[model samples]
Target: MVAPLRVGIAGLGTVGAAVVRLIEEQARTLSARSGRGIRVVAVTARSKAKKRTLDLRGIDWVKSPLALANNPRIDCFVELMGGSGEPALSAIEAALKNGKSVVTANKALIAKHGLRLARAAEKHGGALNFEAAVGAAIPVIKTLREGLAGTGVNRVYGILNGTCNYILTRMEQEGLSFAECLKDAQRLGYAEANPSFDVDGHDTAQKLAILASLAFGTKVAQSAVYVEGISSIAPEDLRAADELGYRVKLLGVAVRTPKGIEQRVHPTMVPKSSSIAQVMGVTNAVTIDGEGIPAITLVGPGAGGAATASAVVADIADVARGIRAKPFGRPVDRLRDTKKAPMERHEGGYYIRLMARDLPGTVAKIATRLAKEKISLESVVQRHPEGVDATDAAKKASPVPVILITYATSEDAIHRALEAVQRDKVISGRPQVIRIEKN
Candidate 1:
């Protein structure tokens, strides 16, 4: 009979408890697949006194995360604690240094200290798997790190955040405002009270940093990602996107360019027919663009205990099967450093929404400014107020919403033209700009 793989888990939150339950429920299948039985030997959490749904009758309650990580009895250390620092980081470091395979779902820590942890794992001869970090149950990390090892990946992008995707989906489907959708998300527990991390794009940025490293074999650096939030998105923008046969989504995009590997997270305009556009609700999706192959897209539930724990257990199974791949697909030394890509140099089509003055010459002035910067327009629409004709609306001195879809242009050129238009007082309020990402 093969020996069982003993597991030590830190932080018995929703994910941790579900992981325990999954291992118990899928014992026979796991044993068959891994060639050994998997067991939860010990666990730790913020509050042991706090009642949990899972029955830990046979499990040892370790004093702390560090203790559980260093326990010699446990062969695999599973970390479900959500933080970029603290006992989580030190515990993971200790586990890897002890030559024990480690599994975690903490994107923040990976983004901040991934290379360092990977280096430690390399030197200690242990596996560091974070399949649940990017997209829960999506298998994106494994796809990028192992399955595509022989292929050349040109670009990898995805809707990695459920909170943002939920908010955006509601806005697009119901024609609701961003604020309204966010409030509903919070009430439904899809978002936190603050919601800045997800809404402001930092959460997506962290996940993107990890994906970029795996896809490009570059050092994972969260600071190198250019981030823009979804809070500025409104219902009007979604309507405009529908009119132009596109959809607005917050996407984390990592692509290779002449300058370097560019990683960014922002509100992007994708064609309505694209696979990414069809992904809605709290679901997540990732698209991998490899050399000489069709684009591969993986989609699934991105959060919740069941989805996340399913991935954590899969990582543990890999450990039981004696499968150990490099932490970032490439050796630590071979991973190149990632320099932050300047947003100003980003070249792509743009969706610009300007509240232009309805007076004569206003539209002419805007066109002249764009032309001066060598920017060409693909389409232009002046949305007059309901029940108001364009000439009549101008006579009423109402501000018209001019939506312009521009051909491929540099970010610097678009900003220059918009700035000139603002200075000329031809438009009111700040202009809304969304980058067009072609499928």
Candidate 2:
């Protein structure tokens, strides 16, 4: 019988420990599927004394993660360390240099250094799999790499960050403020204490960069992604979304444009009728639009110890079965350099909210500005403050909030129009602008 596939896992965090337990508990079944027994031979963590639920009786404890990755007895190195630099990068590098297969859940690492690592993996005759890096347990990477390989994908998009989704979901369902919902998310462990990475749309940007490479066969361009967070999404935004037959979601969207590929992560107004709009809480959903297949939406748990571990194990199983492919569905050298479509060139409908002074010509001036930009108005609604009548509106100097939904127009046009409106001093505050996503 062939020797068992020896595995070395670095980091004993919740996901790492769960991976160890999963491999052992499903050893018999895994062996049957892969036609080769899979065994954990070595492991490393910051602290071996730290109590964990998994039993590590027979597994060799390596003092350094890099040493474990370079261990001759190990065929696969599983990296669960959460960072874009240092130990994780070096360990994976060492393992690949030694021709060992690698499985990682580090999105930041892959987003930052994927091209270099992919080249290394190809040159060294080893597989680098990161199924857990993007949407945990969702099989999005696998789907894009294998299932839809023959199809030409036009767009790749999703709610890639669970923390942002959880916060948005709670805010909409409970009518809570963004701060209140974020606090609840943190308490529930859905968000980090310093949630900027997730809430500010950086996390989604990283994941989208990976997906864009796979779907478009373009170079991973994390730096080119236009990012906007849900921090500005107020309760009023949600209320307006509902009234306008839409829902607000922090979406990571990458699409093929005439000029180039467009990648952006921001609060998007999705139609309430769309499938993705229904995906609530911490769940993630990825929609791929391809040539043959119009669109396919894959939804599942985006993160968590077990969910991420499950994805890691799947990649390991593929490695064991010798089913490895290019990291981005195409050879790293063959991946084309992506031309980033400028955000100002983006064409889409927009939801604009302006606090206009209750003066008679204030509303007309706003329209004049939009008309000057050749931006057509889909709808314009002027709302008075609560308990105020039409007569009171004429007498008061307080600003009346006016909501404008514009027809499809370039982002440049909207910006110029809003700038002109602001200069006129008819609006009381900075206007809120949320892009409308027809998807």
Candidate 3:
């Protein structure tokens, strides 16, 4: 029988400890399947004396991540440290320089420096596996890097962030405001104590950037991906969406249009009947539209220690089995230069809500502006000023609310029409506009 493949693990945090436990428990089974045993020979963290749940008596404990990456006793480096630069970057670079295979769960690191690391790994003849970086337990990175390698993927997108999905799902179901749902999420540990990154759509955008590179074979560009959060989604919008047979989800959408690639993370209205719309709570779903094969959808837990560690162990199993593939599915030099399409060129349906002065000809004026911009409205619901149905309310008050769902139109047309409505004396405050996704 072949000997065990020595592994070095850095950052014995929640995910790190989970990896260790999983490897130990599944060693025999995995070895039989892979024809080689997998063992964690070396481990490293910030503090050597920190109390850990894993039994580390026989393993080597290093003081720094760099030491673990460069340790000669280990054949593979598993970086579970959660960061984009510094030690994580240095350790990964050191591993590649030393011709050691690497498996990581760092999404930010992949999104920011994936191309560079891919080049380094390819240049040094080392495997760079990061299935855990994009989707916690979905094997999405592997799907794009291997399964869909033969197909032409026009778009790859989904609910990449669980915290945002949790908050949005709660808001839609419980009719809670965005702030209320966010507070509940933080208390439930679905969101961080400082939840700006997840709630602001930046976290999803980062993951989308990484997926976009794999799907399109291009360099990851987190900054180029347009982003918008659910912080501004009001209860009224959620109610309006429900009334329209839709659900509001913070979706990371990417498309390969005739013009170029369009990537965005925003609060979008998806038809409630769609499979993705029903993916509620902290769960995540990714949809990939290929030209030949039917659209593929993966739904599962998108976060947590065990789910993420499952992905890390899968990478380890692949290494043990001698399965190797490019970091981004192709040679670094073959990856396309990302050509980001402008947001204005993005064509899609829209949901618009306007608070207008309750007076004669207000709706007519709004319709006229929309007509001038060639934006056609599909449906409109007018709520009485008393916040009740028009038929039930005896007397209508001032500043009535008007919600309209429009047909497919360019973003520029919608922006122009909304701008014209805001300038009119009939409309009150800025109009609320949310894009409607047809996924």
Tens-place lDDT digits, model 3, residues 1-439: 7888999999899999999999999988989988999999999988887787789989999878898888999989999988889899999999999999999999999998999998999998889999898779998999988988899999888988999988887887788888888888889899899999999999999999989888988788998799888888898899889888999999998888888789999999999888788898899999999997777999999999999999999998888888779998889899878866778888989999988877777899999999998988899888875546654442353677899888999998988888888888777778889999885
Q: Residue pairs in steric clash, candidate 3?
A: none
TM-score for every candidate vs. truth? 0.99, 0.99, 0.97
- Which regions in candidate 1 have their CA more than 4 angstroms from the true location? none
Error of 1 at 19 (Å): 0.3
TM-score of 3: 0.97
lDDT at position 185, candidate 2 = 89
RMSD, one per candidate, in order: 0.8, 0.9, 1.7
Clashes of 3: 0
lDDT of 2 by residue, 110-145 (tens): 999999899999989889999999999999999999
CA-lDDT, candidates in order? 0.95, 0.92, 0.89
Worst 10 residues of 1 by lDDT: 389-398
